[model samples]
Target: MKALRVLLLLSLVAGSGAAAEPAADTGREPFVFQSDRIDFDRERNLVAATGDVELAREGRILRADRIVLDRNTGIARADGNVTLIEPDGEVLFADSVELTDDLRDGFVEQFKARLGTGSRLAASSGQLQGGTRAELNQAVYSACEPCADDPSKAPVWQVKARRVTHDRVEQQVTYRDAVLEMWGVPVLYSPYLSHPDPDVTRKSGFLTPTVGHRSDLGVRIETPWFWNIGPDQDATFIPIVASQRGFIGAGEYRQLFDRGRLELSGSLATLDKKPKERARSGPRGHLRLKGESHAGDDWRLRGEFYRASDDGYLDLVGLDSSETLPSFAEAEGFFDRAYARVGVFDVQELRSGVSGDTSPLAGPELLYEWQDAPSPDGAGRRPAAGAALHRRREDENQRVTLEGGWRLERFTDGGHRLEVGAGLRGDFAHGDGAADDNNTRLLPQASAGWSYLLAGGMEDLQMTIEPRAQVVLGRNSADADEFPMEDNRAVEFEFDNLFALNRFPGLDGAETGQRIDYGVQTSLHGAGDWHVDAGIGQSQRRKANRDAPEDSGLDTAVSDIVGRVGLTAGEMTALGYRFRLDKDDLTARQTALDLSVNLDPLYFDARYARAVGVPDPQKPPGPAQDKEEREQVDVGLGSKLDANWSVLSRYRRDLDTGRSLLGGLGLKYEDECLLFEAAFEREYKVAGGDPDNRVSVRLVFRDLGSLPGTQGVLPGGRR
Candidate 1:
């Protein structure tokens, strides 16, 4: 035998004249062959190659131990260790195969293939058509990796079909009489099934269904359909059928553009009507629209609108749990040293006994702020102006404000720091209804502060301590009572806002009179990634402001002491605490604690909070008219039992009332090809009504639209 490697150009022509033309002119690639030994038979127009034969044409390659090609029939046959590589990176293996001259169409025995998505397919026999379609008999498909220790062992999950077809052009796989198996045991059978090819990211199809039981809604199943409307647009429709509640439908539509995106989501349902109802049935629904766009390089426009048919509709449908729905639109701009915004907003109250008409609608609010470049010595100044118009059924008001400020800081070589600042603000307001008056006021404010740092320790351990204090002085507004309070009704004095020049959150109110805020903070760093930090502070005023609310913690000449403490050890444990103590008795007025620990496969987290309301000094000292204390705690823990299994549990309780507010437990298993989840949740009080219990189960098969909770009622009966 002689080793022969030949490049043969074989073309099929319709006539003798066409055969005279070159293969390039026909727009088709000719076959090229290589072999250790080659033979040709002129009478039959056949070529036989043996021992490591290889053929290549148009980006497709075929290799075998022996191959025979017939020029008269444009067919090739190969036996023993046959392998074919397609243009799209798919590899097929068979014991024996027959294919067209171009290798675009083929038939294989004992076929096995490796797809682009790392999945595997095997069949007793396979037929390839037009290079884009494959039909198989007695096929098995799986995305799970086979056992490494024992090659013959079954995968975690697989699908077996009597017949299966894959169409590359349509990017889909269709199966007939398919049986889904787990660990080689058949669990489900379907007459017909289809899914998008692994290469497809999005397509039109019915997504996985959600099955659950709720006390109020009973047993429910939700099946959703997704539509790939276009390259940049899509929509999903979720229709739910409940054993006791009939039907409910929800949908979401989204579109994308070069600079922005828009989304719309809504749901509607009809239920039994009470006496004197205007319509045939009581209808409930909700709509939400959100959009954002870049108007230019420095400006953005954004808007969101939310509306519900009734106060309890969103809660009952597990859509939203907020007590108030708000709608707003705004345009914002950013510049080198300035910022501006224009916006409007409206709110609808959902709390029982609260009239929606009392909620104010604010529109045409304008704001502009600019800051000057800092001076060489670390000094800067900012000037701002704003205007707002507010209206409600009971009252109407308009306010305009102008403000300017400046500050400077200096540091000494000895670790001593100094800061100083001054500013002026003016407010003009016109009110009607509740406050029928016009008011104008000017406030001048100034502040100064100083601090020192001391640090020293070994390389493995370090410690630092810092003491700071600030004094602020401002002229009090004389006629503040003549104007209505719009945005400054609630005030909280905490460590975060202790040293601010103005403690009030809004311009409608201001902290006045001379005051001094002082505090000291310390930290320690040790080996093994250990660290600790603590800080404490207090505020002292020359005279108490009579207009301050009783529970503000700042109504007295000496305000509450606020502090925080934190500790951490590597990545395994962390603890943080914050508290406010009454000045007179040193009693805790408010406190919060948070702890988290991660220990190998197990993790835990907890949060606790408590607040004591201050008694109104002017309330004649009788029984309190409202609850004055609040306490709550939340705990969560989870464990990853193994690489593919996990459990999670959570509980929330009202410590003051010793009542469990909510509790939940969940178990999940996930692997390369499948995900399974089950959860149970209990709510002690829902919408101020009776308790509710729910259970949910979900299954997700890899490479399918089986998201866990994107469309249905999530854990705890919330979406």
Candidate 2:
């Protein structure tokens, strides 16, 4: 309504170059007025402007054919072609309006307005009440552009109500007997509807609802209510009713403090009877909590807690799509070039054949690390160090381990690059159910590397070829097999770790004896913003490490050849490939490829990974047999058919088993006044059941609330 004052003032003073002096005794700012003819009614104490008159006050203006003002009564009337201009450049139109001198109390006929948010409002008649509220007899509103050809035609969508009230004091709009119309046809009706105006960002109300169908949960419907408790805190509660699972309640609470933020979300449901009549399956649910804050100058604190009533609860009720639930809490601190962290974690093993009793809970793990960045002077050296203490609790056994390590390295370049590095690590272990209850091992290692780069290519196509070699010396620990391997389970042989000081990933496993790691890498920077890089490396060990799985490519005297290739052309395309080949037969042991192409309307992304299982060392060695194998592929496609329509598809498949893991297809349409989406998806082996088929649809009207019915698609949490 403030716009009304500005618009009216603009129309009243458009041609008045300067404001007229105020009355001698009024003690008020002067009013600017312009007109073809102005008459002063001395006897009646009235001023009248006729024929293309304009009036302005402050920064507002109003133009009308005739304007009449009664100085004594403090009433103003504007008739014929009335237009008001606001300071923010908003213009309002009305057939005629009457208001007091304060520009608060007013009445408008045939009023049409365009708000700053691109929304449109029209009223048959309106009454200004209490200087802060406006009531309209009959009104219609939309956030759509009217058709230039036929303004009378209905917009894509609109809301029509018998009585509409705008309460400026509350920043809210309320409607009575409201009807939601699409193409002029009423599709939904409600006795009352209210929402925060465009200016209000948060308000308490009923949010959109979700409707879906599942094999286990049957027909699912969830309606969520939002409570805006305060400027920094809010909560949403959703009550779900399913034909198969009965009623379930879920909610999320979030709050932002001066220095941190916290959030919690979860769901609970009660079943009439458990499927397969499992013991203790009456009620199921899951909860997750997360919080982060600054502790001090260089330290930060964070914590997380997640738990599930049962392994199948999430999958059965569609809360979490994963079969595993991991819960943990941690705290961390940071310093210049150094950091420390402590954490405790527990995993709920819901999968069959897995016993939670045997799974150890990480009671408390303390770790510290410090590393210096590469020398900025190009001639300096630095040392890095780390330490850790881990305690785990199994069924009847408790284990404690302490470990520490340090690495020092120096690098220099003079025609050929040279690097010298040394590392030392020690481990102390004391535990109950192990071959060696108490044990200690010390490892010392040293390595030297040299690399030469040959750069010579055409002016437009520059290329570089580099060959590097490193020889590492270490003594094998005879008691390595007597210790328990708790943290580390698998080793990855990739180009990124090809030249690492140690081939094993964790402290529990370390390589020993003499070894030579050599590789040559080449790079090409050609025309058209294109670049290509490739590298291959292999390791030759003086002694075989039978402790490593055969498929790990590190169990033999000669390690498998590992290589990687990367290609990119600006933002439009990217491709990467990494693989390990058998040292003797050159057979692929593990391979992965990732690629993405963004070519305008045509976009594609894909990833494929395959690995041959390693041979089990516990079994006798005769003919090497694969102990495990995995192959999977993921692909996505997106296309914009036109300005208002788009299509998307995604697929995940297990190539080894020739099975489709997950697939989805979606279509979207959007225009000036309407947005529509429809999606269908299938999730296989999720929640430990058959493939779950789901279909969801959504329609949102610009100004009015959206037609709330869709599956609760958790943002960023894909099954």
Candidate 3:
């Protein structure tokens, strides 16, 4: 055997005398051939290579045990373990192959291909043409990896077809007489089927259809069509048919721009039978639109619009579960040391007895804040201002506010920290309609605080305790009673705002009179990644605030005590609790608890909340009065039975009434090539009427889209 390497150049024009020219001079890549043994017959224009033969041209490479080529005909034949590699990372293997010298057009026996997208295809024979198309007979396609322990074992899922065609230019695959198999067992058969190749990012097509059963809606099926309008925009239209109800139409459209994007989605339906409470049948629908854009280098604008045909329409169609719909538009600016914003908003009430007209419309609200750079001594000044207008059916109100503040901090060598601050604010307000009034007032406020940290611990255990105190003195607005509380309708006293110069959340309200807030926060860390943190605080005012409501928890001289506790053990377990206790009786007014645990195959989580309402001081207790006491609990549990199977369950109940609100159970199975899920849910309470039950199922094929019941078939669709 002779190891010979030859570079062959063949010109398209016969007898052009370019065979001896260099590959670059001829303007075409020459075929570089290698073999341990080679023979050539110049008269017949034939070349033969044997024993580890290899040929390379352009980016394509072919190798085999033996090869024969005809220069005049530009043909090549390879036998014994033939392999061809394409430029785009595709590898083809066959027992024997015959192709043009360029390798674009070929015929292979016992063909197998590994695609760039991690998919596999195999056929008894295949024909490659035009460098972009392949036709196969008796083919099988799958995305699953072969079993490592048992190489001959069947995949989890695969598609077998009598004839298969792949079009690289179009990025699509079409199959005839296709049969879907699971574990080598035929489960479904189709005369014709087609899908986009894995390389296709977007294409117009009909997505998977969803099927489900609901107690209120009966049996329903939804089929959606997606339109790939352009590179920057797309849309999906959904049409649903129900056995017991009317036909429903829904759609979503989205577009992207250089500086912004917009989206709109909605649904509409006309019932076949009108409800007994309505006089006539009418169409019900819901609409939502959202958009955002960059206005400048440091500014952005955003807006949202939402509407519904009726209160019960959303609930009946399972569109949304919100109790209110809100619409708003706003612009925000960000600077090095300043911030500004302007916005307008409105809300629509969806509750049964609530009137939308009662919801206030607020617009043309402006807020601005700026702060100076801190000096070497940690001292700075901040100025803030705001204005707003609110309108309702009964009245309209306008307000303007301005404030200035300064602060400084110092840390002592003895582990003591001190802080001081002061500010002055002015407020102007006017009201019309039911309450016609005008008022102006100037408010001055000041605050000081101190804290110290104490630490002690061993190598395995450490502890730290910090005790903090602050005193705030502020003068109330002289005409506080002349204006209504628009943004400060609900006031909560908690540890989060215990030490602030002004505890009120809105400009319409302010904390008045001198008060002292004190709290102690402590933490402990032990071996095995265990830790605990706790804090407790209370406020004491010099005198009761007449402007504060009785149930606000801050109207009395001694405010309610607020505190929280948290514990964690590594990444497996966590617990947190927050509570507000009445000052006089030390009874809990509000409490919230959360706990979660994760132990390998098992996981659990639970949440509980309770709040006690206070009676109106001006009204006597009676059976007709509304009770505000509320308590609820939610719990979830899950377990992984094995590598491919899992079960989950959830329950939510009203503790006060001992009634279940919602409960659900789910099961899932997933592997390398397939996923299947089924769920059952029972809703014990709904806005419109009686209890409801729903069952849904979903299946997904790897590298392919989902078979939908609740989940969407496209990328980023509903899940």
Which predicted model would earn the best lDDT?
A: 1
User: Cα miss at 207, model 3 (Å)?
Assistant: 3.4
Better of 1 and 2 by TM-score: 1
- lDDT: the better of candidates 2 and 3: 3
TM per model? 0.91, 0.85, 0.90
> Which pairs clash in the backbone of model 1?
none
Candidate 1 lDDT, tens digit per residue, 272-321?
A: 44345333346688899999999889999999999988876776555677
Question: What value does the lDDT take at residue 15 in candidate 2?
Answer: 24
Give per-residue lDDT, candidate 1, residue 312: 68
Per-residue C-alpha lDDT of model 3 across residues 1-719, encoded as one tens digit per residue = 67788877554212235533433354767788889988877777678899989888778889999988866666798999898988887788899989887788989899888887678888999999877889999999998888899978989898999999988888788899999999889999999988777666677766766666667677767777888899999998989776777788999999998889999999999866636644235888889999999987899899999998887677666667777889999998999988888889888777765667667787777778888788755555555555555555656777788878878888899989999888888887877753547777788888899999999999998999999999888874335577657676556666777776766678788778878999999999999999999999999988887777565678888889999999999999999999889999988887899999999799999999877663322233333333466688999999999999988888898887787888888888888777877777787863336787777666677656432343632211121
What lDDT would each prediction earn against the true structure? Answer: 0.81, 0.72, 0.79
Query: Highest TM-score: which candidate?
Result: 1
lDDT of 2 by residue, 1-719 (tens): 11122222322322223322233344444467778777767677677888777776555677798888776566678899987665555566688988765555789898777766688778999986755677987998888888889999998788899999977678778999999888889999999988766545677777665666766677777677888899999998889888876998899999999888999999887876646746355677889998988877777778788888875677667677664567777778788777777777666767654455545566566666666565543222232222233333432223333333334444455568777776666666665656667777767788888888899899799999999999998886425576566555567888889888776765567777788999999999998999999999999988897766567888789999999999999889999999999999998889999999999888999999989874332233224444567788999898889988988888998887787888888788889777776677787862255687766555655545432343424211222
TM-score of 3: 0.90
Query: lDDT score, residue 205, model 2?
Result: 73
Candidate 3's C-alpha runs over 4 A off are 1-5, 11-26, 34-44, 50-53, 274-280, 376-394, 434-436, 476-480, 614-627, 686-688, 706-719
- Native-structure RMSD, model 1: 3.9
